[model samples]
Every structure is written in C-alpha cells, then in structure tokens.
Target: MTRDEIFKGLNEVFQDVFDDSTLEVEEETTANDVDGWDSFAHITLIVSVEKKFGVKFSMGQVSSMKNVGTMASILLEKLA
Candidate 1:
C-alpha cells in the first residue's frame, strides 16, 4: 500500500485504540501530543501496525520510535 494508505490504516487503529475519532494523526505527530497514549497503547499500536502492514518492527526500532514522523520514515523503509 501507499504511504497515505498506510497512514490511513494507522489512523483507524489509532482512533479505535484511543477511542477518539477527533485525534488526528500526522507524520510529525507524537504520543506526547496525544492524551492516553501510554506504553500499553503503544505496544498495541505497534502490533496493530504490524498486522495492518504485514511487517515486524525490530525491538530496537520499536524502542526508537519516538514520534509519528519517525514511524512513518521507518515504515517507508520497511515497506520499500
């Protein structure tokens, strides 16, 4: 899928997990910017992304995902 499609899928997962449709997700967005996005939700988000994208995030990569832009960049490499 394209980057927009990938981000769209992630947005859906975000809305579902966060239980808030108003939460807009952008490449530069960060967990710190969003309320209720703790570690548990973070893992769930990672798993959901893996399932959606059919890819696995290395443990180091997972630990390094600080913001949505970083994630989008990594996803780009993984999907590429």
Candidate 2:
C-alpha cells in the first residue's frame, strides 16, 4: 500500500484508539504529540495497528519506532 493509504488506515486506528473522531496523525506524530498516549495506550495502539494491518511488529521494531513515519515505513517493508 502507498504511504497515503497506510496513513489513511493509521489515522482511523489512531482516532479509534484515542477516542477522538477528529484526530489526525501525521508522519511526525508521536506519543508526546497525542494526549492519553502513555505506555498502556501505546501497547493498545500497537495491537490495534497490527490487527488493522494484519502484521506483527517485533519488540525491536516496537521499541525502535521513533514516530508514525517509522511505523509506516516498517509496515511498508513488512507488507512488501
């Protein structure tokens, strides 16, 4: 999927996970950028993203992710 496509789905996941229908996430988005995105929420976000995209992220991948852009890149690599 294209980056735009990935972001489209990711946006949906973020909005749902954060319980904010109007939430829009960009490549630079990180936990600090979103309210209520603490550690627990991070785990939930990761699981939700995996389920949404049908992909699993390694612990390294999860820990190393710097931003939504990195996650999108990883998703692209895995999907490819």
lDDT against the true structure, each candidate: 0.86, 0.96
Measured by TM-score, how close is model 1 to the native structure? 0.88
Candidates in order, TM-scores: namely 0.88, 0.97
lDDT, candidate 2, 1-80, per-residue tens? 99999999999999999999999999999899999999999999999999999999999999999999999999999998
Best of the candidates, lDDT:
2
- Predicted candidate 1 versus true structure: per-residue lDDT over 10-68, tens digit per residue: 88888888999977799878888889898898999999888877899999999898888
Pairs in steric clash, model 2: none
Model 1 scores what on Cα lDDT? 0.86
Query: Candidate 2: TM-score?
Result: 0.97
- Model 2: runs farther than 4 Å from truth? none
Q: Name the top TM-score candidate.
A: 2
